[model samples]
Target chain A: MSIDKLSGLRVLCVEDDPDIRAIAELALGDVGGFDVKLCASGAEALSVVDDFQPELVLLDVMMPGMDGPETLRALRAYESLQSTPVIFMTARLQPDEIKEYLALGAIDVIPKPFDPMTLGEQIGGILDRHSGTTGYR
Target chain B: MSVNDVQASLVALRSKFSGRAREEILFLSRQAEKMSEGKLTGAELSEAYHVLHRLAGSAGTFGLPDLGEAARVLEKSLKPHVERLAATGVADDAIAPVEPLFLRGIEGLFGLVTDQPASVPDSQNKTVEGVDDDSHGTQVRILVCHQSADVRLSLVQGLARYGFQCLEVSLTSPDLAGVIAESSRVASVFVVGEQQLEGVASECRSQNVGGRQLPVLCLAGHDSFEKRYWAAEAGAEGFFSEPLDFPRLADSIERLVSERRYRLSGRVLIVEDDSDLAEHYRLVLESSGVEVRLVSDTRHLMQDLAEFQPDIVLMDVNLAGRSGITLARLIRFEPRWLSLPIIYLSSEDDPESQLVAMSEGADEFLSKPITDDYLVRSVLHRCHRARQLSELMNRDSLTGLLKHALVKQQVHKELASCRRLGYRSCVAMVDLDHFKQVNDTWGHGCGDRVIKALANLLKNRLRETDVIGRYGGEEFVVVLPGCDVGQAQSVIEGIGRSFSELLFFGNDEDSFSVTLSAGIAALNDFSDGDVALEAADQALYQRKSAGRNGVSVYTVPE
Candidate 1:
């Protein structure tokens, strides 16, 4: 059941932590009921961007080489991914920081230590709110 | 991803990731040691922070909150100096404080690695489902306050359809207020045929407690006037007869509990010249439940900082006529915006210029044509880190309570609130009796445990809204926002009694109980928080002069 929070949604998750990555995988794929792709790092995520053609990118804030925001910038280089909603999943939550993430073009910031059970709902809720907005894939 | 599958995956990942997580901390610590010895280059210092940064961000998620927390503190403490070195090519003089912090982080990891007993496997702590404390915001909990077990069970089942899957409390639970306060915000409280609703009712109506307001409804077998009157008098918002208008009741519960509002979703102010790119960014941010404002002109950024109050700044290094680095530096010039994160979006990949921009006050430098994911993640991390560091600065390193100044400030705010609301508030001064002797006799480690035990007692005993602060080395001050002198004294006395009962172990084969003395002052007795504090301190002094382990109230001097 691929629910239509954002129409025909496909999500690519990039995280360095394997545990978090797996949790996100389940949250996005199983609980969220969406077409999902998981990548270990920003570099791997960038390599598969065109092939996966995800409508949204769920990224981790901290990574080994090219971090999440750097990867977000790289994703925008592709003509196909310019307007995609990028959500950052991070353990670090300070209100100002969330605002900063927004300033950086991320549609949302998901606090890390995220609940796998409600993770899908949280993402879907964000998608549902933004679903009506124009110019979003 | 069923819940079970997610849990299974978590259990599996725990085993896989722990070894690597250890390596991650060890590597960062090694770099930190190198930096301490003045060996790491400026680039290496920045690199060290990033590696620790990743570890800090992930360690908590991997069932190692202690390691994650240590890494977080280490990352934040090292960041400013690292940024300074990255920018100015400054030597290692600024890094004097960083080495110890790095060593401390390494020590925390080492503690984690060595803590497991020989008999227990590593897998025991790794299971997500096993931890009683881990509530991951999954099942919906409804606290059922009924005097009958069968009725409680039935009501629990009735609400199951609407997704109130877990029953937090039943008829046997003595204090509904305590249960509700202890649990992660119960969705609703259904009081079935109960006459006295004092505990939960006080909790539900109280603005001072600060727990999420749960709708309280009463259901009785008879629609008698006395029952309805009692329910109304008891502060039940809704009353239902035996047949139980289930639909109407469900509607009320939904209206009260499920209509939860979004709390502080991210807000952004974009300072970029590219109109199309700005629009794209705005849409993306807005879609993810973020509030976005675009300003192509950089002339009035101070005004925007006041109004929009962005957590992170996203601007191009080369803007229209004005350099983004210059703007970043200007922003940092103001004390209020010093910690405001600024991420520079530039097309250049040159490391030297990046360092210059960083030196100029940019928190991060992202090359242009940045992927949507990369841009978002950087902004998020910078913003979060800045906020966390500021928060950490306000907290005590030992007891994890508010620092002295913050406690006094909180008392001032609460006293002002007490005046406006015309409610009684009280301040308490808590001091351990014969603490120095305990420290001298049992050594500092045992003394520390005794201090921590008291703090934990205060946290457990006090309400969430009540402000607690570590006022001194062995003293704590608590501001009870809405508590009168009597209520405050009883609460303090309860803590004192419990603390005296607690047994703290000494160095070898000896263990002894620690007793604490407390003094309470009412807001009405003094003009401000400081004055109230002085009165409380005086009362505390009196308690110490008399037999210890007693709680004394301040009397107004004529």
Candidate 2:
């Protein structure tokens, strides 16, 4: 069975930097043609996840308070989002750090300075592979 | 929305980011001052780290890669101090050892932010000198003076296909010399019929654009030895026979125009420990319009090489402690820089020592106590020759683009940069659609015209930073740094549409158009350059199978 393309897929992005957030908005919303909800912090992302029912989460690794990992732990408490895939974006991605993120249940890790034009498609590709292994809906 | 709209928005967004970056730098500098004064808190140090981290992560995306790199370096150095401060809840004593370093780093970052003169988007700023106009945003113009209106019309229309906008210079003009002189400032080349060749050529010969003679190409009524001789005597740089072959004529004009453009000054890196001697070399080279960078510390030589990308290296035979020969060998250890010319400066007149230095990767040895004139002449000559040799080795002669191996190597370098700096880039594989049919239908000449046309189009449209290569017979590879596959697809599609509109003349009176197909793969997704290129090729195959003349991004099959 082939997974469908991720066009119009709902995604929640959590990033603290306003400039990067604005860039992500243009990349995912205008370029990627995805339904993207941007949150300024992990706390805001947790608040919006249930209502938005996003298919995927893009979490920045570092934030002022309640960072990415803690946010992921908090996010898993939601029953609907438990199985939803999450990807971490970070500036530093050492091999061990990647292992740690994967161990924390991140489907993939995207480095910072990501091409805004292809961010949505990259996430879609990540999701397709993740679903292939887990037989996710 | 169109790709242009997206690109425009990105430019706007980048300017906004730059403005914000200025304010952020100010905030960081204030924090640095507080730290230096021993009044900063642990939380404030953490804040400074985050600011630097954010700058490192996003500056390149906003078209400030150098600034981003500097920030990354600073962040890496500050990471340990920040972590220790967080653990100990003490900032002043913990950071006292590196306070001066932090202050200098912040000052450097501030310099980088302020040094740039109101940033113009890279695309707009990097138009090739001879090909584009800053005011009109149009192709290089050619002044055409022909006796017959029909011939002028044909010439104008034919040259338009080759990206030249021809302005008609009527033979009936009262002041032909004045007209030619005035137009010579804007036009790159003059294409005149044999009837008016002598007058126009003479006027053009007397005219100079930026101190170089304006080129004139003569269109002869028929091919003859006397006509060619006369044309050459009349100051025409190029001669084309009647029944014009547009491709060949345009090719000649292009070459002449490029040759008329000023050649860039050679850059030389001087690695000398003697401060006085280094300053002397710098002054002498600078007077001759040579860009000179001096390095006193041998430890930073590699970093300097990577940053400056000089055309040649001038080193002293004896450093304070390090041997110049050993340093030359160390530079040659990297395969990428093996071709760089290294000239040693030494007072050692022994032929045996000079030969020893030459064997250890030194290209030439210049004895000390040399006059400034000798130094300038030798360095400039060597720099020019080295550049010429490298271009011959690494570029495809037809397209003036990187050869397949060099482009592949570029992909690997960009991928490694992406991994280290957390940036994203894309590799695109482009092939002309139905190119075989084009060759069979027209001829090899027309086929070559199509290839050259596409190459010119790519060069005109893409950013200067993008690496374009002639990968195969009719296939080209373009590596776009800091672009996603989506953006690459859009850009390639735009090129494809423009390419299909281009007209190529066949042997007969008729002209035909050709189309191109392209596929893009995000560089960071694949493990290496070869794998990424293969994936892009696979996508190209898929596009060809789906009917050509389109762009596709590589997607994984679930």
Candidate 3:
């Protein structure tokens, strides 16, 4: 992962579990070489998205307070993030289950027990497909 | 199963498995089992625990020395596993050692069991077999996160051979929850190994990754009943003793897919006098795979019945002057539609009206202030039942076309506005010239033949966008939307000429033909509908006076 790919990229990660959060940060930040910020709740993600000014967001579908899909909904309220590529990370989803999330405008979903090494790559691939270019290099 | 039975079993299991790590293990094991059984996270696990805890204490009191001693050992062992998993974000490797021992203990108890229900032992039977249908095969999505990319690919390739859509999530860097959550987007099942069970479940639960409720078939390397039970507690819906029983796992997935398919896809029928309500109903239902139809007026009950064939006729009971009960009664009286579900929707709350509506054959009645959820459920229930009825009755009333019941439906569209924003609606009444003479001269048969010919001619001459309705004998009403007097006159005149050109023959009489006189009227948007009809009727009379073969435009007397 190069800084050029991640140079101006900003990402908001919403996850309630710390171990999962840490691994996501490492993958999207160091391994993927992207700028990433983390929030644990849907409400928090909504409030911080503008401040973080992220180009992309990796949201976890389930959270203690506000889950991933709800966070995505809040993300949609911001005109800037409305069209921003969002990839949902969930363990309990099936391709069919993603229909509602996709209808809500998520670019893709990444299953749980994710591989730390390729987490960035998978997200980058989805972003690339949706925006015609990946913010990550 | 009864809560008490579950409790007793848990108690017996707890007492049989007590150890230093017993508490966490028992809790985790029971929870994982429940999860694997398809219970969503936030499911109450305490009941199961209360039973086990009670059993552990009671076993000692009952003086079944071996049972008491065994339970103590199990309980003591269960607690530490929970601690280790929560602290380390992974299931403890310690569970592996107890696999054979736990199974042996369970079997030993089963062997000694006296009078326990046989059904209780078959708890594992609840697991759903996934996506059945072998000849064509199915694409089962698998989420795999392991240390090696090779391992992931190998699993993927293997699953692909079985026609599965294999999605690989690597676990090397941790964040197992994120990976599992992401997997939900692609795979139907997440196969987490024993080592990653605790972390995966917690993370998944947080993400609501299937609420940790969807099937996450665990593959354990060892036959560890303790670990299996632990995996179930963590929200895995199914578990496989490892070496991966691919066939059985596939079967489980098949069952899960079927279960999900059977989940409700609501059906709704919106009987709305308001076009906007009808449109809203269409929007909500179509998106959710609901079949919807709209009937603005209750007068055309039979027409609506024959066409729409809605699972539930969602009626705007108080449509204009007609009561919904009248229409419901009309439907219920018919043998074909007697049991048809009719849901009366109204703003009126008179108990008398509700009772009348119910008596009139409405299966369910809802008030106007209905939530989207309630509307959805009511329609779903009714429509589901309606679908079980035979297929002949689905048709539409206004145009005498097949109703939304038979065809896919779109919202009742409002007219595309014209510049005159006011009631500038055009009404054309085409009546026969000396229609009584034709009836007397050619016997009623000639008159009937001529009327049919005129109907056909008017239909052909008018613009396809126009609303044409048969208005009694020899007279047809046509609504030309967005049309002024000029457009209406021209269309009506053309139909008049076509009616004259129509050649008709009676059963035993000479060939004869008839001419039509049309009255066209355009009303301002604010004009009353009845006033427009009267004006149009007056103009029609004027055309009759003007030698009967042309059209006369109505001009409001200033």
> lDDT tens string, model 1, A1-137?
11444434688989886667775776677666778899998889989987999988998887779988899989889999999999998877888989988898998888765645456656765665455321101
- TM-score of predicted chain B versus true chain B for each candidate: 0.49, 0.66, 0.38
- Misplaced by over 4 Å in model 2 are A1-137, B1-157, B164-187, B207-211, B257-262, B347-360, B413-426, B438-446, B481-490, B505-512, B522-528
Candidate 2 global lDDT: 0.78
Per-residue lDDT tens digits for candidate 2, residues B1-558, read 676887778878877887888898889889888888998888888888888889888886665654676777667656766777767777636555455656766776764542222222223222222233321133567888888888998897777655566777777878766666545644778898999888877776665532446788899989999999999999888888867876678777767765553253688999998876686667556645577889968899999999899999998989988999999999999998999999999998999978977998998889989887789789878888888788889889887789999999999999889878776788999999999998998888789888877887776566667789999999999988867676677777867876776666786478778889998898988778899999999999999999988998899666
i-RMS, each model, one decimal: 12.5, 12.0, 22.6
Give the TM-score ranking, best first: 2, 1, 3
lDDT of 3 at B412: 13
RMSD of 1: 23.5
For each candidate in turn, the TM-score is: 0.42, 0.55, 0.33
lDDT (Cα, 0-100) at B40 in candidate 1? 74
Clashing pairs in 2: none
TM-score of 1: 0.42
Residues B93-176 of candidate 1 have per-residue lDDT tens digits of: 655533554565565565443122111112222221211122212233455666766766666555543333434354355755
Q: Give the alpha-carbon lDDT of every model.
A: 0.68, 0.78, 0.56
Candidate 3 residue B398 Cα shift, in angstroms, is 44
Best by lDDT: 2
Residue-level error in angstroms, candidate 3, position A84: 38
Model 3, position A13: C-alpha lDDT score: 85
